[model samples]
Target: MFYTLVKIIHLLCACVVIGYLIYDVFIFSHFKKNRSEVEFIKLKRELLKPSALILGLAFLLLLCSGAYLASFYLGGELGWLESSFQQILVLKISVVGLLFVFTPISFFYILVLKKSDPMRKFYHHLALLICLIALIFAKLMFLF
Candidate 1:
């Protein structure tokens, strides 16, 4: 029961982050770039702050649940480190860690750097790629 609950929570959190990343990467960021001053200001006032807060919370939940899930298989007979799945899992975690780091940096850039800055796109696309990779790793983990 506890494992199932945690797995569900973990999957939900991953879904939240992945959905938001895809939207931000392919849609929101581009829309933000092209929006007029009034539209951009409206976005900053209404959406940006709330989205950041949600993303931060989602990332936290994902991190904690993911860590808990990983802990179950890391030692004893499961020995995740010895399995073929270990490398991809580790890579996914590392990418998630990078996402965690980049989240704040992207926010800081949004706050400080001009909207015209292309760097945020770089970060967004990188995050999108990692999210896709993590999803694939997740599937492989279930199968193998």
Candidate 2:
């Protein structure tokens, strides 16, 4: 029961981060050019803090819960790390680790750099790609 609950929380956290990354990369970018500079700047300023909070918190929770769940699979008589499924989990965790590094850099660009810079969009797409890779590994972990 406790494991099930943690799995649910982990899944929910993944959904939150993935959904937000999708929104940031696809929907937000599409809408960005439609607005005038002044309006867009105002909107960006308003949305930045809250979006950061949501994404950061969700990603943190996801990593924490993932670590908790992964503990069930590590270092046993059968040697969990030697299995293909656990290997895929390690890959997923590694990819997520890259996201952990990139996220702060992206946030720094968005917050400290000029709002109109193109790097923000680049970072968003990069994050989306990373998340997709992790998602793929997740499926593979279950399959094999």
Candidate 3:
């Protein structure tokens, strides 16, 4: 029952996070470059906080539940690690680990760096790319 609940939450959060990540990468970033100031501010005001919160919760739930599921169901199985499924799972986990590292640095950069800093945009785009890749790899893990 506990596992089932965690799995549900994990899946739900993953959906929300992945959807937001796709929008961030393909929609929001493009708007950042091309949209008018008033339009961009409106979009940013409407989405920035909600997206961040959802993505943050998704990451948290994904990490906790995924680790629990792995440790609970596959802890003693060496062959699982040797399987193609496990190889994809390992890659997914690696992407998530990279996200864990990149997220904090991105947050710090946002908090500390001036908006005028040229690297801010680069960092923001890179972080979004990481999140997108992580989401894609995570889905791939379930297929194999």
Cα RMSDs, all models? 4.0, 3.6, 3.9
Would you list the rank order by lDDT, best first? 2, 1, 3
Off by over 4 Å in 2: 48-51, 76-80, 103-118
Local accuracy of candidate 2 as per-residue lDDT tens digits, 57-76? 88888888899998887766
Q: What TM value does model 2 have?
A: 0.80
**Model 3 clash tally, residue pairs:** 0
- Whole-model lDDT, model 1: 0.77
Comparing 1 with 3 on lDDT, the higher-scoring candidate is 1
Clash counts per candidate, in order, are 0, 0, 0
Better of 2 and 3 by TM-score: 2
Clashing pairs in 3: none
- Model 3 over residues 1-144: C-alpha lDDT tens digits? 988898898888777766765676678768878889889989887878766776777878877888987665353656557777677777767766665565566566677773444454455466567666766876776777
* Whole-model alpha-carbon lDDT for candidate 3: 0.70
The candidate scoring highest on TM-score is: 2
Candidate number with the higher TM-score (1 or 2):
2
Q: Which prediction has the highest lDDT against the true structure?
A: 2
